[model samples]
Target: MTFDPTPPHEPRRPPPRSALGPRQLVGAILVLLPVVLLLGGLSRCSFAPGGPEIDPSAGPAVDAPALLRDAARLAPFAVRIPAVPPGWRSNAVDRATVAGGPGTAVRAGYVTGAGRYLELVQSDAPEEALVRDVAGTVPPPTGVVDVGGTRWVVYGGDEALWVADVAGVRLLVTGSAGEDEFRTLAEATLAGETLPAGTPPPR
Candidate 1:
C-alpha cells in the first residue's frame, strides 16, 4: 500500500474576529443614550404635564349684561316705595299672607348699600308670626336689642318688631349676597324709603 499521506489539512483559519469588543459596544451605547434622552426631553417640552398644550386664556368671556338679567330674575318682588332714592331700581311687588292673621300683611323691599349687597325684606306678619317664622327658619337670636325702648330679637339675618303686642313687623337685612357686596347693597337700600307700617309680608 502506498502510504503517502497528504499533508494534514491546514488548520481551518479561525473565524474572522468581530470588530466590536465589549468596550466598543459599551462606548456606542453611551454615545446613543444622550441623543435618546435629548429627544425625549424635547418631546416633553412641547406638551404640558399630562398631554396636549392648552392655552390658559382660551375660556368663555363673562357677559355682564346676561349676569344682570339673571340677577333681576332672582331678585325678590317688592314695591319701590316712592321714597326710594333716584337711580334705585325695584321689582314688582308681591304679597305673602301668614297662615292665620287678622288683616293681610304686606312684604316688600330691595337691595341696598355699596361694598356688600344687602337684601332688605320688610313684612307685616304680626310680632308673633314674625318671630315664629324667623324661629322656624333661622338659628335663635344672639340676643335681644332694645331699639327705642322696644325689645327686638336679632337673628343673624333678620330683625323683628312687636306691634300692638301681637302684630309683627320684620326687617330682614340679609348678608345673603355675602359680606362685601351686602354692605354696598345694604347701605343703598337702607338709604331708600322706610317700608310703610302695614305693608304685608308675602306668603
Candidate 2:
C-alpha cells in the first residue's frame, strides 16, 4: 500500500458556552432573593426568648368592697357592689363627672375570670348624658333585654353597652365581657342590696 502523506484533519472545536446569560442570571437572582431573605428572617426569629414572661390574666389587686362602701357613704345616688365569681378581680374605682350634665358617676372596673375587662357606672344622670360620659359617643339604644325582672337597654354592636334604671339611679354596664357575663353582672347588681349615702356621725 502506498503511504498517504496528507496531514491528519484538525479536531472540530464546539462553540464557546457562556456560564450564564445576563437574562438567565437576572431571573435566577430574582427567584432566589425572596428565599434568601426569608431564610435570613427565620434565622433572626426566636421561638423562646430569655425574658420575663407576662401573665395575661393577672390584673391589679383592688379592694372593691371597701371602695364601694366609701362610695356609698359619699355618693348622692345609691351604690351596689356585686359579688363576682372567684378568679375575678377589681382593677379600678373612681368617680367621673357626667358629660354635659349636672351629676356625678361612680365607676368600678373588673377583670373577669376569663381575663375580660368590664365596668359598671352608677349615676343619677339621664341615660343619654351618662352614655355620653362613659362612651365618647352616645349611640341609640339597639334593643332592650329583660333580665331578672329588670329591663336593660342595649346599645352598640359586639362592643355592647347596657343601661338600666334601678334603685333611684341609672346603672350602666359596659365592657369586653360576653353577653352571658353581662347578664350575670346585671343580675348580681339587681340582687345586691341598695347602699345609700349615710349621714356622718357627730365628731
Candidate 3:
C-alpha cells in the first residue's frame, strides 16, 4: 500500500474564506459595529454631546400666557395683553431691564394670522436703544400708519416696523410680517389695551 503524505482527513479550509468582496467587507464592518458595541457595552461609544436639533417646520411653541403673567410685575405700566387677532398667536412675552440704564423693555412675540412672525416691544429705553433692540435697524421713519386712534411709524425693509408713542412709552411692532399685518396687530393691541385683569395693586 502506498502511503500518501496527504492526510485522508479533510484539511482545514483556512477558516472558510469570506464571500464578501472588498466593498461588502467595508459594509459588513459598518453593520457589525453596532453589534460589537452592543456586546462590548456601548457606554464607551463616542457621540456628540448636546441637545437634539430643533425642527424648524414645527415652529417655536413658547408659553405666552406665563410670560405675560411674569412680565406684568416688572413692566413699567400695566402690561396690556392684546387679544390675539384671528389666525395670529402670541408665542412669548418677556420683560428685561435695560443693562446700564434706567429702563425696562416688554416684548410680545407672535406668529401672525398669516403665519408670519413679529414682535411687539414696549420700552421706556431711549428711542435709539429700544429701536435697535426690537428692530435691529432704525431706518429713517418712512411713514406713519394710523391704527385706531394711535399712529404707527413705518420703517422699510424685507422686515417691517410699525412704531408709535403712546402715553410717553415707545411702542414698537417689528419683524418679518408685512406692513399691513403689522398695523393690524397694532390696531388690535391698542383696541384691547388694559393692564392684566385682577392684578393686585403694588403695595
**How well is each residue in 4-121 modelled by candidate 3, as lDDT tens digits?**
7878897666534466578877887999999988978766544433222222335766766566656776576656666666566666777787554467888888876555677888
lDDT per model vs. reference:
0.41, 0.80, 0.69
Full ranking by TM-score: 2, 3, 1
What tens-digit string does per-residue lDDT give for candidate 2 at 52-162?
222336747788877777777778877887877777788888886787998889898887766667789989998888888788788878999999999999999446899
Best by TM-score: 2
Error of 1 at 172 (Å): 4.1
**Off by more than 4 A, model 2:** 1-57, 199-203
Summed backbone clashes in each candidate are 34, 0, 1
Higher-ranked by TM-score: 1 or 3: 3
TM-score of each: 0.33, 0.69, 0.62
What is the alpha-carbon lDDT for the whole of candidate 3?
0.69
lDDT of 1 by residue, 1-203 (tens): 67756657766565454855888779999999999999999987753332233232342233322322333333332222323333333332434555554323333333322211223444554555554553455455565644334444555534322222212334444433444333334344434443334345333
Q: The CA-based lDDT of model 2 is what?
A: 0.80
Better of 1 and 3 by lDDT: 3
Could you give me the TM-score of model 1 versus the true structure?
0.33
